[model samples]
Target: MAAGTPRVFISHLSGVAVFDPNGDQVGRVRDVVVMLRTGSRPPRVLGLVVEVVSRRRIFVPMTRVTSLESGQVITTGVVNLRRFEQRAAETLVLGELLDRRVRLIDIPGEEQGQAPGQGDGEEVTVLDVSMVQLPARRDWEIDKVFVRRGRQGRGGPLRRRGETLTVDWSAVMGFSVVEHEQGAESLLATFEQLRPADLANVLHHLSAKRRAEVAAALDDDRLADVLEELPEDDQVEIFGKLAEERAADVLEAMDPDDAADLLSELPESDKERLLALMQPHDAEPLRRLLSYEERTAGGLMTTDPIVLRPDATVADALARVRKEDLSPALAAQVYVCRPPEETPTGKYLGLVHFQRLLRDPPFTLVGSIVDTDLRPLPPDTPLPAVTSYLATYNMVAAPVVDESGALLGAVTVDDVLDHLLPDDWRESAHREPAQVPVPVPVPVPVPVRGEGANGH
Candidate 1:
């Protein structure tokens, strides 16, 4: 058959002799197997089984089969039937390991529903019985074998489709008439589902190139999440493997605070190079963030705050709020500022609550409606004080100002939390207990008894 041509049912000519390339009779055809193709017109022959005199069965592909003549089969290569026999007897391969009925044991905490006798114990309580079978070549190795009802389309008389058990190659302990599928590919698939923190942990266990391969496979959003969780040093190191444009794309997709943090750790020259490669708009925010101290409110805050002109109507403010890509932390309140000044000094009058903005009349001026009682903090204000101020006012965020009272940025509650409770918060602090004053013990000068008293 042609390389890609589809084939139908293949006849298993039983008792037909199998011969080596030298024409010596070796074995007899035992079985012919067909692997069903989902979209193809006809199923194709996966391989052939030959039963040898040693009571061992070996699998040979139809591709290696040359011809079928009168009571004889011809093959291309002189495969040591012994080697094939040894391999078949030693390990569980696809054909023999499947279709045998086995019990399914659910791992604790992994069960979705409460089945009888299912708990956090290792007791091999039979949850369900299923027939184990080999998977197609394209299936993941860990999932090489599947479990299903032995009889197809039969009702109440036997097993139901719902009761069938599926076993992963990794879950099986031993193989008797069964074999486990490869686990490497399945592991990769499972790795893909892990959260960014878990994925970063796995990445720490892999080599740099493997890390790059796994990272390259992730979607932009997922990749950005993982990048944000990774150590700053690791971020720079892994980013080195990606193309400049690809790296720029990922950085652009990352949160402004996270992207700024990563860039801050890079050498100045590298930072400039990466920023230059990024989209102008994305790079602009990152540049602004980079200019601030890492622990400052401006550094921790997101630059995507919603701002409306003081002279604009509440309707216009509401419209702007609905249109901008504001973070949830900053979405509750919108700042009212003047148009971009020549020097861009913070000329904002106050902020308006989103609820108030929505409720006010359309013609109400934003400045007239804004809450002037808003609490503002300087960018240089300590994080503890910033957090305290927000807590005291019960504000989602407080506007950050420079020495000139020009609105530089707004610090959200989330940023304050991040600054106060870092990932390695404990590790960053001294481990020793704080010193406490101990009472000084008074020492009594013990007089030499005999010398102090007059000699007797």
Candidate 2:
């Protein structure tokens, strides 16, 4: 530990209230984002996931944090309202680091965290971690780990048998990528709090064997969510490894458009086999989607969109719009239809933007406030037409209606962007896995839990 370097344990920041420079409350810290580096180098702290008043989690870069004392965080007052989206190289310290089992490199004549009977590579369960700003630099890095000795139990580390200790970050091993026989259980448990896209990013960088193990361990809904965010080749590879019945279940959990997109990549026999395993009702939408050209509105549109009958109240529409799983684009508006609310819904009456829903009384009928001025796109609309339609109207999502004026589905901006971007875009932007150096014993002072060098 450096003599004058300021440091604070991450556990202290969990759920701490954050305020602006003027002292007005902004949000609460949810997690610290960091990028785990190669070898013994400490992971660089990136930012904080702050949950704002509306419960929308946003990122506050560490550079923006002016103070971290008194059990509260103070930011620069300027905060971005955009939701935090974890990237490929980033890791959430609180979500994916704590409770992880790592090892202490055996240093002759020097020890602290190791149990009495344990030899070299003593196992420890991470409890907390501390970050320190580099001397004369604004960047912060994880420098110390607070861990408990012994195997973890269902409740937690066995209280009677485990001894907690803190050690320098370099004294431990297993934080970086390594080719070994590690199971995915601990990794999966630590990743439970990550969003699907974030989890997909983690999986994208993992070894194929490890990726397969983790995919097999994930539940149908979770695997489906992760699959939707993965690259086409990865999706096919993972899907091919699942049991037929499990594959069918995962397909059912995926959005119809995504399921169709994935299925289009598989051989006809394989696609037919999986579709045959699925429920007829679930397979129908995929079948409809598969019938269209890959770049057409029908192909790009999600079969499921927010749909409400004309007579439905604004309250009911708002309730549907508030679902957490719906993307911002899909949640931007609700479609008003006659009946058979699911797409292809009965005669499309019009559409109601979320803003108009908010402006109207709760008891007001959605039909009354619906916007009929904007014309809907046909399923056969080309990709260029869909792009122009959305861009010209400044819309995040556009409606797709059949010739009979039935609400078919909706094409969201994300889907449009996906089609417009290069096929390898997702894979091209990520950084390669960091190199891991062999662990060597090093003599270093170990700090006990709850005490940082800065004495915070």
Candidate 3:
């Protein structure tokens, strides 16, 4: 680390507020741009990719950055409003570097051959990289590499590991012009371990082309999860890029309510085409959801909750919940129904909250202990009514029924919240002064200065 240089992990820069010299908020930092160099000579930071109030991405050259510190980045107020087009040689720290597996130049005997590797080096996953502004040149460069020594587990949570190595940038290898060309290749496996929301956050920071590339690399189920977390506009864009069959498969993997919401964002013709390509069983629920006004309970409920017979035992109910790869909210409760089968289920009986199932003996019949006190929501119930119903019942999920009392589906809390939020909530959430954005200007270089923020 250079003396008098302010050091920060690249992640700490993500979403931090960027202010002009006049103390006007320019935008929030979306990505850090760095040009790769030979021999791990701490790639020079090029500039920042900033999204302004209007959602336009502009570039603020490194030379314009007066300070780079904790919660804010102070720039010289000379932003180039001409949109940022990532050059072929530049690497986006958040978009392309984080989570990438790289080779650590192993010092022969010091490193046991435990880490996964190729012929020349030991493999380590880049958790983050620290960048610093050298006082003299006043330029930023990657100074330290934070890495987990192993080929990260793919497709699930990573196993806890040995101490993370905070190595000088030179001790790290693998970042190259070749990596920038290959795209998220070395990072996809690591991405598999991220929660859908986390992956969506990362995707939101990439260029459209790079975002599509990463989205294409994800498995249908993973892509579905990620898509559900994204804004509707983003959802539509990525879904449009998929082959119709693959898009249908991705929709099938999504919660029916989420899939319906996403499909509703499309032009009716495109929506219908995708629906036609889906398996009939998968498409039916979404079709029914689409038939309703988006603010209605019918439109917000997923048709895939674990459904059990009135005669089913706790053990049977437990088995169903375990068998399905349902989201937490969906798995929070089970519906007891009179049925020839689950979907288009016969009659809506009472419900059994998961906690109740856990409380009773395994052999106890779920129907015998059902909670019939909380009434099922009508398919036509409006969004406000649905929100109130959920809040009053203190329920994470509520069942929906048609006029005939046949079970339709169940609405989860998250779905209702999405509806209740402001139309631009997704965008606003990213830049709001009171939300994720730091309300205080941080000491980036000389001192902090901004509205709604205290200077250091």
Question: Evaluated with lDDT, which candidate comes out highest?
Answer: 2
Instruction: Report model 3's TM-score to 2 decimal places.
Output: 0.65
Per-prediction TM-score to the true structure, in the order listed: 0.49, 0.62, 0.65
RMSD each, Å? 26.7, 10.7, 9.8
> How well does candidate 3 score on lDDT at residue 56?
55
TM-score of 1: 0.49
Model 3 lDDT per residue over 102-132, tens place = 7766433344553433224666777788888
lDDT winner between 2 and 3, please give it: 2
Predicted structure 3: lDDT: 0.75
Best by TM-score: 3
User: What Cα-based lDDT does every candidate model obtain?
Assistant: 0.56, 0.79, 0.75
Residue runs of model 1 more than 4 Å from their true location after superposition: 1-210, 219-222, 229-234, 319-325, 341-346, 423-456
Q: Candidate 1 lDDT, tens digit per residue, 1-456? A: 223222111222544678767766656665443433232122334345564544334455554566654557676543323212222122222222222333333332345474633322221212211211124321111222344433432122333443434443334333332222212222344345556755664454344655666677676777888887666556878888788888888999998878888888778998899999998978988898888777777777666666777788877776776764456777788887776621123576778988897788989998898788866777667777887889898888888766765676678887777667755532222111123221212212322322111101
Please say which candidate is ahead in TM-score: 1 or 3: 3
Question: Residue 453 lDDT in model 3?
Answer: 12
lDDT of 2 by residue, 380-421 (tens): 999999999999999999999999999999999999999898
